[model samples]
Target: MSIVNIIEDLNPWDKKLHGLFQRQSTEKLTLIFTTRENLDKNSRLRNELFQRYSVPEYIWAKVCLRLQGYFGAEDIFSEDGSTVESHVTWFHFEIKYPFRLPKNKDRAVAEHQPPTPAQKDGKKPAGYAWYKMGVVTSWKAPDQHTIIFFDAEDSPAVGVRNELKCNCENVKVEPALRNPYWAHQFLLGPILACYDEAVWNLRDHVKALEQGRREGKHTVTNSLDSNDRDLNESSTTFNALHEILRHALHKTEILGVAIQTLNSICARKKIFEEERYSAETVAKEETVQNMVITKRCARKIAVYLDFQLSIVRSLEARARANEARIRSEITLAFSTVAQLDSRVQAEIGHAARADSYTMVKIAAVTMLFLPPSFIAAIFSTTFFEFTPPEGEKVSKDFWVFWAVSIPLTIIVFVGLYPGNRGLSVRKHISSAAHHKATTVGPTVASPAAPAANMV
Candidate 1:
């Protein structure tokens, strides 16, 4: 069999070949490929290329006419012996209607009529077969140039690519169809999976923070030890941790979008492969399944990625506010706990940390003292009998009345105090602060140890 050289001679084709892989045919094939490997391996195509676009309805019609050769010329997306000159001629024709449907009346009809099963969707056609959107076609001419139809305004390839969630901007021909940094590298799983990891991280972090906030744990915003995980931290350490998270949120969002888009591309590849079949047979169920699965996976991944991006952006704002809130509370809590009014502050702090049961008990005890104190205040001076025992009745006065009233008040307060609940809450808060202090405590001398004498 003679070598097919339909696309080798053109400078345009050659330029497109760099960073791109082309499978040299026993014949020349000017059409773009699904992967770089396609250029080197010569075989029947069982897998269809991924659609990286979503074509509008009108251009789809022109592609149908071009495939049917309504231009009175070679099919623009054929595997036939297309020459470089034909490509040049097609380019001239296609550039005319960059965004419009073909001017030819017959082409308009062919595009309107469906020919593929994808258009039928398991239902019998209603007099007219619908068209599949992304099928690649070629137009060849006697000028020895084979025109690739993917870039043609009429070709379904570019338009259908929109179904794929990738960025196809300025997509010129290249020797390779992918970039090393962006390719399916093992360093990270597929792009979709990577996005999933970030989402998980954000979710878990938020959950933990909410729990800590409720419990008065003095939780660190985000942090890392030498082992690369968040651990206990001082106020300073947590401050640094929040700053780092704030910066990473940006990077995480960008990666999330990219991963989602790649997953979508992978998914679209499966459906496209099944759609490659002609009207003859639909037996390749596995191929159909693969495409459908990949498409679904891609769609899901894109959704999550978008969601993650949005969350991270908003989370950045929220976390900043939250971190500041925590920091301020911590500062105030520390000052209160350490001052001369420490027990009073501890009571407040205890209430802050107390369980519902504990808070209820403390509240009950505080309220219990109010009535006796109020009664004493009202009767201390008004009741002369009680006071006379202080004057002539016992030669006592207001001082004596106060003397008895004050002791009774003290006793009442002592009896009504919420002993356990207040203590439990105070312990919980101090324990959290203790953990924070210990994490950074190594740098400082112990409170129990005396300072070393200086020479």
Candidate 2:
């Protein structure tokens, strides 16, 4: 099927979606190996050589679906089938790569964007960013091996193309098996390279996190010593690292699946070669050479695949270890902050207790002099003069004053300083209440007793 037909059938709204983007045409990296010319050709065009092959319609549909950012029934697509005189396969997967971080003081920093004011002041820290590359590879029949790299720029793709150029003569020249699958190894090389780069980026990120954690430890120590409770920087760093590790782990899992896909391709290619060999009743010299080369290629690829798997495993293990380390650091930071908070709370409690003691002392002094001052002021008033006018006898009104003042003074003292005296007063009141209750109980029971007897 043609690429246009596949696109039209799979995504009917393709033309409408095109107007939304004001960008240039897609930058696709396509490598086409053709046996007709006995050479490989490079193209920037999308699906130029893919249309020349006898690829199954289903494969075309899968590629179309993947390009549209959707895989209908499965998240991963790996389909292989044989056509007359050729073997075909289609694969699609996403791989991650770290985005370029800005430089600071001749070193790459972990900040995804420019640091905000808080980050600049060391109140917050930033994390790295990663972007996903959607990659698709198609091995078409009748001498076409097409690899398509989408959403990637020229660097890695150019490197792959250059490597293929250097090695394509082996497959094309005489005495060298013209098995195109030999080129498959180089095709997959870039993916492994991408994974290697990603893992290294994560390693760098882990190192940065370790450094940050150590620094945070010192900062927290100082904060604890100085009684500074603000720990937003440490908390922010923890959260950022947590998020980065989560993404890194997920990408590692995808890498695992991708390695599996690579293994599957190698296995299926071997099986296809075997089937092709068995179906030939009379093996020509060329066929024998192709078979030998296919076998050797399979063995070499197996070793390579093993190496790839081990590398991925090692990288994954290291990533998980880094994650665990970051987690431990976060726990320690939290504990440190909690300890600081507890200390601050204890200090605050002591201060509050001291304030209460001071207040009590002031209250005691007030209670000591308050009654006499109040009494003197009252006596100095016109109504109760200590030195009366010569004609006026400081009369019986002074007795009245004494009678009112003495009792009032005693009541005021009892109310103001109700220490043990308050308890004694309460006990006396309780006794009176109990005595009244005892006396009333008999009278109340007398009525009930007579009524009960009548009953």
Candidate 3:
């Protein structure tokens, strides 16, 4: 029943009221929300809507315009028509930032690498695997429900009771708990993507097994012989399915490594503190407020979350690799089979040509001698003037002609057989394809192995 919920506060309402959300009733497990900031622990860079924008100028201008409007005035433009602004300054009227933007600022960005372990020397933070949690106080654990309760604060962003004072009826009322920093909707999709990739990977192993089975069955059926039956069939999908299972195991291992990497760097994500402190580390150490006890349990939690993340990631990756390999193999097999098909067609063509050639040879020979055979038969039966030549009669000389005819017939069949030798060359489709799983976990060069701490 212990469910670890990772909720990010996006708007001021979500930031303020998430802990106070007791649904219509109040019987649920502990709810903890965590947040990160660009400033001191309490003062987070509240509303950051432009994380992934390639060109932030247009959007930043809109933001500047909105800020100016918030103060009831027009936004100012610079003499060069460039821009400037405050960190969190309110413009009573049109206020422009005095500085110029860097050239190539649009193209200057890095690929998003997952947070690596925070380190000092070669060791991870003395306090490692930091993430925030909250225990929703309005609700209580009932019966065995206590098993699910995490005694930690539900969120590091502290002021809950005071923030929920706005009436629901007001049109312009500030939200009960909207985070000022990042928007939840945007993050929602990515978070779900991570979860989904993990879950779906676990599920596809079954399908891979099934596909391997089907492939195996077909291979056995296709034993090449005159009767098309074999003493034994080799290479079945059943074997392939087992191979897929083995691969799934590898994927699981890879995921474990990824999870560990993620957990080691969890602190980088964000953690809004309950007590106002200059930095997060100080807040965690100094607070007498509801705190997460760092002991054996913390390590266990870190290990567990890391492993889970890794397993999911590895499986998902394995599933994809397996799929790609399977597809490539199938496509290659198809290509091989295509060559087989061509050979088969050629065999058909050769057989047809042999038959036609044999017939042509026979028919031409038969037509050549048919008139003589008919003339000889007519003279012998009618006792007419078709007489013998020199010492030999026409009928008696016919035996001489047949001797020549027999050799010609033998030559035709022999020529035909030799011409058809290409058909006898063995037709073989490729019989082997292979891929499998591999181990995954902490590595010697893994980024998760904390190096130095960044305050």
Candidate 4:
């Protein structure tokens, strides 16, 4: 379709399109801000056009909403009719950080000034204490000869625009190839920057987690004194590794989507290659060259995306390895703690057995002296006294006393034997019954009785 027809069909004045188109004339309205600077040498003219075409807040909001919905609801590589027909591909990407934003010190100070009523009640500000935030959605349309990047509130988008403007100004290109070359340059800058940042962050996080695992292993090895501390350290390291793996996986997913999008673009270029060149005539040499340039640039982009995918895959592999290492460390820590506990319990049991043996020896010594002491006490009693009477040298009944004492002592010892034997027998019987109950099977007497009756 002709430019006029496209504009008329688009209806720039319409409510939906007005915010997007309001800032510039329909004929000169290029989505690419960087290219406009190259197309116009005069800084004044570029500024004037930018001011005139600057999208209104309402339109910007709508654009953001559309981008969010498209990204959230559709596959990253899915194509629309606009992409197929016009040889334009639309892509959306996001960069996220796992950590929360540090609270804005200035904002915090301002809120605390004079102590707001909520502060008086000991409550903090209404917003998040540790703000978890991310950049706005970024969208790009890489057309056959023109690449348009929608402005967003994201730092990456801003960085891309600035880099593209600088590259466009510095690079000297033939008039025929300028658009095609710059389009690739524009698309490459943001993607590469983001990819590099993701790789750096992932590497650092993985390194930290690995370091923690090493430290935890060292602690477990050196000191068995604090099992709880060692286990806690291992748990922390494991959790960190899990987080890193999650981040790495997310990065790989985005990389894959990007690679797929570039592949789709390359596939379209290949399909239209013949038709694109066949239409070229002597009158359209410049147009033919531009198409050729665009095709070559698209191929380069696809190759770069493939390289990035490989890098991302490597990062994912590293993360997986770290995860496995952390898991192994956790298992080792648990095993070490268990073994230590078992050893401690065994030592306590040995100590208890030693104490029991000492008590048994003391009881044996006490029993050895008890019989003699009992005999002496019995003889010294009034009934069998052997002490001299009044100053007499000896008692007449001393021999009788000795004879009676010896016999009585022997009799007492004999009498005690039956009681001791009975007690011993009772103990043996109880032990035997217990052993039988524990180990022996019940016996059936019916077969024996039947055999006896037959005999």
Best-performing candidate as measured by lDDT: 2
Q: How far is candidate 4 from the true structure (C-alpha RMSD, Å)?
A: 12.9
> Which model, 2 or 4, shows the larger TM-score?
2
Cα lDDT for residue 177, candidate 1? 20
lDDT for each residue of candidate 4 in 1-455, tens digit (9 for 90 to 100)? 21211111122123332344444333211334332223234444334433333322232244643331112111122254222122333444444333221332322222111221234468654311111111111122222233344432234455555555555443333332322222443454455555555444455555554555457545543345645776676556556555666666665555555455445544544454444345542134336566677656556755664665465456446545545554554566567657777877888899998997787577555554565566667766897656677879987765764575556656554544435665687788899878766544355445556563332
- Provide the lowest-lDDT 10-residue window in model 3: 139-148
After superposition, which runs of candidate 2 have C-alpha atoms over 4 Å from their true positions?
1-49, 54-83, 99-181, 215-222, 225-243, 246-250, 263-267, 270-293, 365-455
Displacement of the residue 83 alpha carbon in candidate 1, Å: 15
Give the whole-model CA lDDT for all candidates, comma-separated.
0.36, 0.50, 0.33, 0.44
Error of 3 at 160 (Å): 27
RMSD of each: 23.9, 10.8, 25.5, 12.9
lDDT of 4: 0.44
Model 4 residue runs over 4 Å out of place are 1-20, 23-85, 98-151, 155-158, 168-185, 212-222, 227-242, 245-302, 314-455
Better of 2 and 3 by lDDT: 2
Two-way lDDT contest, 3 vs 4, winner: 4
Top-TM-score structure, candidate number: 2
Report the Cα lDDT for residue 370, model 2.
69
**Per-candidate TM-score against the hidden true structure:** 0.21, 0.59, 0.29, 0.47
lDDT of 3 by residue, 200-255 (tens): 43344444444544565344223233123322222343354345445444444434
Question: After best superposition, candidate 4 residue 27: deviation in angstroms?
Answer: 8.9
